[model samples]
Target chain A: MVASFGPVALAVAIATVFGLLPLFLSGIIVPKKPDSVKNATYECGVETIGPTYIQFRTPYYLYALLFVIFDVEAVFLFPWAVAYRQLGLFALAEVAIFIGLLLVGYAYAWRKKAFEWT
Target chain B: MSFLSCPFPALVCNPFGLARDGIYGLLAAIVPEPLPTVALTVLGIAMLIAIIALTVMSQVWVERRAVAFLQERLGPNRVGPAGVLQSVADVLKLLLKEDLIPFKADRATFVVAPLVVLVPSLSVWSLIPWGPGLAIADVNVGILLVLAIGSFTTLGILAAGWASANKYSLLGGMRVAAQLISYEVPLVVSALVPVLWAGTASLQGIIESQATVWNVFVLPVGPIAFLVFLIAGIAEVNRSPFDLPEAESEIVAGFHTEYSGMRFALFFLAEYSNSLAIGALAAVLFLGGWQGPILPPYVWLFFKAYAVFLILVWIRGTLPRLRYDQLMHFGWKVALPISLVTLGATAVLVSAVQGTAA
Candidate 1:
């Protein structure tokens, strides 16, 4: 396991250095010029209207949550597929049950209007 | 035939005997056995680093040229032959640019998000058996590991978008989270077709089974699964036609909008490298990975990988971005059901065949 992770650790370290070091060097090398307009949020060429930060609708969160549950469940299907031939009918039956459960969940969500585009 | 004059001279000279004698001499002199495992580990790390670096650089140029060709314009031709060095030049420019951090952004999470995206993308390569006995790990759960690591990328994208503290960034993050999670199901389900056919989660075993007849030919459903996998994989990586999160026209570069210089570059690296990862996985799972005549295994592996990468480039150049609602609907309504049904049918067929065979 240690040997296997050696490359990953090195790659991460290199990526971190590549990402952070240049930024640090630039801050020291470049001149800083500050102004109110420079720091203001860019909204095309038009004058700023309303606050830049505002609370978004909750539906987006619901969509994302639903996505996660389904996405992960989907991932579980790959391994089952790989072992499909070996699992034979038994594995197929098991997956059917799994999909059935997921469909039920989907139906409940649909009934609750989780997917409604509000 | 006279052994001395024949090509069997090496055998006649007792090469093994001589080598054994030499080893005995070395043992007498207190020499230890060379650590082949350590050497192999070091070599694997070096090779992986090189692969990641090259994949990122080459993909940048490929994407630019592909997009340019599609738009009927010339892309970067001055720096090197056929603008091959354009990506290198971009790297230099990024290196010189100012690194900016938004004042309101969460610094730690903001800094870590890129790493989170990049590291998993790179690590997935470990489980990918490039050729027989060529991979870093031939673990039985290799396929599972790849899926797990692939999904972690959604978290990274969300983190980058949320921590940036910009409205666009937050929106981008939410979009990415939804997109990635939604497409992941179809991707995994499609990948399962091969595993089910091969009956092993080990990548090497899958490829070995394809030696006689490629999986693409074995089942009529294989190509469909490959297609689904490719589409979903592209969406997972947030590429064109599914790049709602980073819709530059709308989100101003999306999740990494607030990032600059190297921080932004990390995200770029992650995105391109992840593309290569998915491309490679697709080639191995669907195409006959490293199973061609004449050429060595590693060479065939690289060819398949590059070919898949080119396909991605072609799609990016040819296809327009899907509307965000369309993207979501396609994933949930279309891909999910298709994959689920495909998986169900595949299961039934495999069992029926096994029952007959047994």
Candidate 2:
């Protein structure tokens, strides 16, 4: 298993160097022109008001919860799908029940407005 | 041409395989055990980097000119012939520009965000099968690894947003976190249809299975899987129509709002690389990757990837961006279910028709 991934490890290693080369070069080749005003956070031309890192309330929180549940469920689906030809209809029944349960949760979330963009 | 005389008639002739065997044999005969391996490894790395640099340069130029053609304008015609060297100039200017960091930003995370964003795109390229015997990784769980690595972009985007310490950037980051994760379900599920039909998650395995017939032509679920995969893929790359995070008119450059100079260009580079990854995957999973007659297999992969990317550009030119609510609602309500049903349908239909028969 580890031997098969040798080429993949090499590929990632090569890509990391290529990807980070420019940022490294930019630091050496380009001079920094930073100043207090120039480095301040942007908000159009107006001076920024209020703290930029204040506690934030987001409507996406419920969706985030939904994502965690569904994403985990997908982990099982992928393997089952890959091995479907080998797995008999009994395995299909198991996947169907699992997917059916998830769909119930999906509909429940819908009814509960977990996906609402409030 | 020399590799065409390969002995196995049942298996298609693989030029890459022949070249690899020839070089390895020559090097091993001339040198000791470890040295030949090291030399070949270094050569492969050099070739990989060269290919990436060339791909990025050409992809950016093609996209700009294509989008320009769609908008009825000449793009970068002032630069080298037909503005082909425009990206080279742009890269030089970006390198020359002063790098800036916001005063209140989280210094470590701010510096690391672009690198994180870039890794997923780079990592996926390793596993994608450009042709038979052509993938760098060629591992068993190749497609699974792709979905796993490709999901890391959200972390980078959110980090950029939070580290920037700007309201709009945070909002943009939040949108990306939601958007990428949501679209991912459909993308993964649609990809599952091909995996289920082909009975393998190795990208090369899927491509070889399509040697006789491509996935897009399979009855019932093939076209549906392709359709969902295309939609979610466009969203996954943050292209137009699903570009809520980069909605410039509303939030101003999205998560990278405060980035400038090469740092910003790195983000841009990663985004384009991700788009290429999507095109490559779509080509492999749907368009009979490297399966056309007559041409070298790798060339077919290139042409197919280019055609898919051009379709993306066309859609970018034609479609209007979706509203934020509509985007999220549609992902959960529409795309997700369609992909799931297709997956289930493919399992039942394929099993009944072909699984037990085998």
Candidate 3:
């Protein structure tokens, strides 16, 4: 398992360094001049009104929670798929159970209107 | 037919292997034992950077020209024959411009966000099979890795929007995050259809399975999965129609609105590169990567990839930007349901066929 990650780890390190090169170069190559007005938050040529940070709706969190359910379901399905041919009918029934449980939760979420946007 | 007479086979089968092996040999000569491996890895990354830049540049030009054609106008015909060099000129201009970050912007996050967006786009190419021997690293769970890595772009966009300290940017960033994550579920589920059908998650194996007939021909479910994958892939990459996050008419420039100079260009680069990467994955999963009669595998792979991308370009020119509510509704309500059903159907079908045959 460790050896399997060798190439991936190496690739990531190299990619990170290469990816950052241009960002580093930009600081050196380009001019950096900042004034108070120029650096201020952009509000379409007008002074900012009130606080900039707005509170997002609670519905987004609900969407995220619903997403986690499906995401985990997908994760469990991956390994079952790879060894699919070798697995007996018993294993298939287990997966069916797994999917059924997730769908139950999905139905619950739908009834609660977790999917509905306010 | 004598093997000696077939001059094109070597070149066609593995065009990149010679250069890659040469680099390895050079590393062997210069670097000591353990260091050579790392050096070769670094060289592979450097080559990836070059490839990303070239591909992104061409994609930008192609997109611009195609969109222009759709609009009844001539796109960039001045600089180099047919204005192919226009992207180069654009990049140079972007590089020379002053890098600016608003004072209220989250200083560190704003500065680092572009790289955060870019690295994933570059990294996903590692698992992609260019030809027979051209894959840099053939990880067993290639599709999973691609999905996991591809999601980081959302993090980057969130960073850009939140850091910008601008309302529009913040809204754009949140929209992007929501849209991307929601679409990701369907994308992964749709991708699983091919994985289940091929019985291996490795992209190369999937391609090999498609040798006789591409997966798009896999009756009833194949075309459905392909369509779902394409739509979700488009959203995951934050392209047109699905690009509610950066709707220029609605949210100005969206998440990257506050960004300027190379920082902005990096986001642009990441966008097009990710577009190509998504297109590449779609071609591999459905259209059959590097698999065709005649022409080199790499050539075929690129041809198919560009074909997928051009269709995206056609889509951008054709469709109106989706409303944010519509985007969310479609992802959660429409795409998720279809893909889940398809995955279930595929699993049942595969098991039945193989079990009966056994």
lDDT of 2 by residue, A56-108 (tens): 65567777888888888888887887777777788888998998888898899
TM-score of 2: 0.93
Tens-digit per-residue lDDT, B1-358, candidate 3: 1221223657557655687678778888877877776676667767866887898899999999999999899999998999999999998898888888898888999988998998888888888988765677788898989889889999999999999998889989988888888998999899988888888999888887787668888877899999999999899889998988989898888998898888899899889988889888998999988877667777778888889999999999999987777888899889999998888788778877656222
DockQ for every prediction shown: 0.36, 0.67, 0.61
DockQ, structure candidate 2: 0.67
lDDT of model 2 at residue B194? 87
C-alpha positional error of residue B51 in candidate 3 after TM-score superposition, expressed in Å: 1.4
- Rate residue A12 of model 1 by lDDT: 47
Tens-digit lDDT string for candidate 1 (B285-333): 8887766765555667778877787888888888888888788778877
Question: Could you give the fnat of all candidates in order?
Answer: 0.33, 0.69, 0.57
- Best model number under lDDT: 3
TM-scores, one per candidate: 0.84, 0.93, 0.94
Candidate 1 vs 2: which has more DockQ: 2
Local accuracy of candidate 2 as per-residue lDDT tens digits, B204-290: 888877877789998878999998999999999999989999899998888999998888988988888888788889988988776
Q: Rank the candidates by TM-score, best first.
A: 3, 2, 1
- Candidates in order have lDDT scores of 0.73, 0.82, 0.83
Q: Comparing chain B with the reference, what is the TM-score for each candidate? A: 0.88, 0.91, 0.94
- Predicted structure 3: lDDT: 0.83
| Candidate 3 Cα errors over 4 Å, as ranges | A1-3, B1-8, B19-32, B356-358
